[model samples]
Target: GKKVIIIGAGIAGLAASIRLSIKGFQVDVFEANSYPGGKLTEIIMDGYRFDAGPSLFTLPEQIDELFALAGLKTEDFFRYKRLEVNCNYFWEDGARLSAYSDLDKFTKEVAYQFGEQPENIKKALDKSAYIYKYLAPLFMHRSLHKWSTWLNKKAMASYFRIGKFGLFHTMNQANQRQFKHPKLAQLFNRYATYNGSNPYQTPATLNIIPHLEFNKGAYFPTEGMHSITSSLYTLAKQLGVNFHFNKAVDKILVKDKVAIGIQAGGKSYDGNYILNNMDMVTAYKTLLNEEKQPTRLLKQPKSSSALIFYWGVKKVFPELDLHNILFSKDYAKEFKAIFKDKDIDDDPTVYINITSVQKANDAPEGAMNWFTMINVPNDQGQDWEYLKAKARKAIIRKINATLHTDIEPLIEVEQILDPIGIATKTSSANGALYGNSSNNRYAAFLRHPNYSSKIKNLYFCGGSVHPGGGIPLCLLSAKIVADMIPKP
Candidate 1:
């Protein structure tokens, strides 16, 4: 069997390692961190456990597909339940809404709370489904850079219908036109943030994001989000894939324009092929410095990052679901702060995810673990210390007003992860949560491809590459990379 070397052990890297090994390649994964999982890892302090990153779990079939390929039952190794209540909403004005997982129920709640027609919400989601149905098959499932993909009759059909996607309109424009009330438009507009994009500037084609939650559904792993990584990591090891931790890859060794191996841990380990799972920007700046850089893709704007406060609270709030959003009063103004001004607004939208709501062990008895976060511009050499201080104050103020509690006093244990920490830990350039902001209509097409054009036997996967970020898209990136590789 031919040997392959993979850099990074992020979700996409783990999935790709398993897929490659199953295809008869001797896979060796090198991760800089002492542990695997990258951002999709965990944290424990003062009897509370928190998923460090990427809380939302949609497209369970992506994880299921990996297990199915390995000849195992998915539930036997990993388990998750569909969230009945997707998320609870709160506004400073004392308005509230419960987003039930059931489409009919959610639509009814939207209508009842926001005074929009129930049918209108359904129609909007249907349009989202239409885009996802057509767009995913054509662009997401395969490599857009490949001519064969463009030549496919199915892709041709999708290309002809681009106008129907509202590609010319901004997401805000689409949402506002669809809803009579400002709140409903604001609620749907928040979907743009799923990929760290700004609805005011991002293309309406990104509206397909909602269908994933409202139609296909969102879920939670029974063992917490870290289980997604642990279960897959265990499966990869069991399948005979070798992983080297704390071995940072400093350079990608290439020979005559062909990727040959990696230089890591001050040693060179050769391979027949190279699978680079590192963030694209960081990889070019560090690992593949000598290789011809894809400057165009590199120039694409980095997506918004986050400022998270992992707090172990002394009490629980029954009104809160597994997910809760304390929306800012002015949604458009909030986005302007993040994207244009490169700062967080005084009233930034705050997201609170409590895994303890489902699994009791995540927090101490009669307590909750709050994964509180707010979106901010990715690290541009900003004064994060000042930003963090301002953000903490704003988050405390919002939570106090919306949830009706003095949360600062309830915090028994606390830790903070700003964009600088995110970049330092994950090697995601500029600490961008997603590789690039899908602000432009062509962002989906502009992402780096699965395989390198100039470097043979060199491939790229993970959130930084084609198909974009999040758990599902990262898995899809692995699939696309695997499909392109010939069996060993």
Candidate 2:
């Protein structure tokens, strides 16, 4: 078997290394940062811990499969519990909604809160399930470029059922058709942001997101979200996978259009295959500079980025749940500012996630660890400092008004993550959270492929490439990359 070199120690890289090692291939992962996990990381501030990125966890089966492949028991290393209450929502009109994990309970709640019929909710879920059934095999489980995939009977069936996938209209339109109440429509439309997209413009195929959460059930990692990274890293190391930390890969050596190795820390590490788990944009621009880049795909519009504030609160709110969203009155205007105007909305909807509720060790006995986030436009030469300060004040005011608590005074510690910070830390271009925006119908096909068409032995994984971002899809991206590698 040939030696494999992987760039970046993110979840995708770790997963690839584990899979390759189990297949009897020698795997060496080169990570620029001292720690692994990239965005799936943790930050400890004065004893309060926060999973710096991706608070919500869904699809535990995908993670368990990785452990099983490594010949390890999933329970022995990692564990998670399904969330009973997925999230709590607050509206501007003094209305509140507790999104329960139980489907019947949630449907009844929606019906009770808004005068919408439960049958309408059931119909929407049925449609979403149909979309998932057709698209999963074609778009998710296999590579679209592969000949075998296209030739398969399942692929042919998917091709015929493409109309049901809603390739023509936007997600907002689809939701509006499903629910008569504007609030209910807005509630479903919010799922589009799970991947950092605008529902009004993004394809209705995105409606499948809610089915992933409410149907499959959302989860909370027992030790916290960062435990996911820690457990995977441990499993990878235990499987005889080597990791070179703080070693930035400077270039991907190409000989006769074939990748031979990678150059990092003034030395060459040769390998039969190269998996780039770094951002696709940075991987090509920095590592494979001599190769011709995918200009059209690279130039495609990016999804919205987030401006986050990690606060160590001195007091805990009993009214707040593990996940909470404070919706803005004008949802259309808010998205318009992000997608069309390319700026932060004046009244941006705020999402506050408190991990201390689930894991008491995350904060002191009387305090809470708050992960506050708001969607914003990707970096396009905006004045971030000014916008961040202004947004912070507005968020404080909004929370105070809605919760009836002056939250500003209880902030014991404060840290921020903006678009610039996101880009610098994760190597993502324009700090796009989930790669290119799904605003257009062609975005699914327009995304950069896991394997390079131009450069042999060079491959891509992680959020920026196929399968797209978020924890579940990022794991799927790694699976696609690993499957593409030649067997020993």
Model 2 agreement with the true structure over 1-488: per-residue lDDT tens digits: 68999999888898888888888889999999889999999989898999999998988998899998977799999989999999999986798999999889988998899878989988898888888888888888777777887898998998988888988899999999999998889889999999899999989999888888888889999999999999999999999999999999999999998999999989998999999999888888899888898989888888889999999999979989899999988899999999999887778899999999999999988999999999999999899999999999988987887888899989999999999999999888899999888888888888888899988999888888887888888888888888889887
- lDDT for each residue of candidate 1 in 1-488, tens digit (9 for 90 to 100): 79989999999999999999999999999999999998899999989999999899999999999999999999999999999999999999999999999878888888788788988988999999999988998778998888898888888888889898989999999998999988888889999989989999898998999999989999999999999999999999999999999999999999999999999978999999899999998999899898788999898898999999999999979998899999999988899899998988999999999999999999999999999999999999889999999999999999999888899989999999999999999899899999988999888878999999999999999998899988888999999998899987
User: Candidate 2: TM-score?
Assistant: 0.99
Query: What TM-score goes with each of the models?
Result: 0.99, 0.99
- Which pairs of residues collide in candidate 2? none
In candidate 2, which residue ranges exceed 4 Å CA deviation?
Answer: none
Error of 1 at 64 (Å): 0.8
Name the TM-score of candidate 1: 0.99
What overall lDDT goes with each candidate model?
Answer: 0.93, 0.90
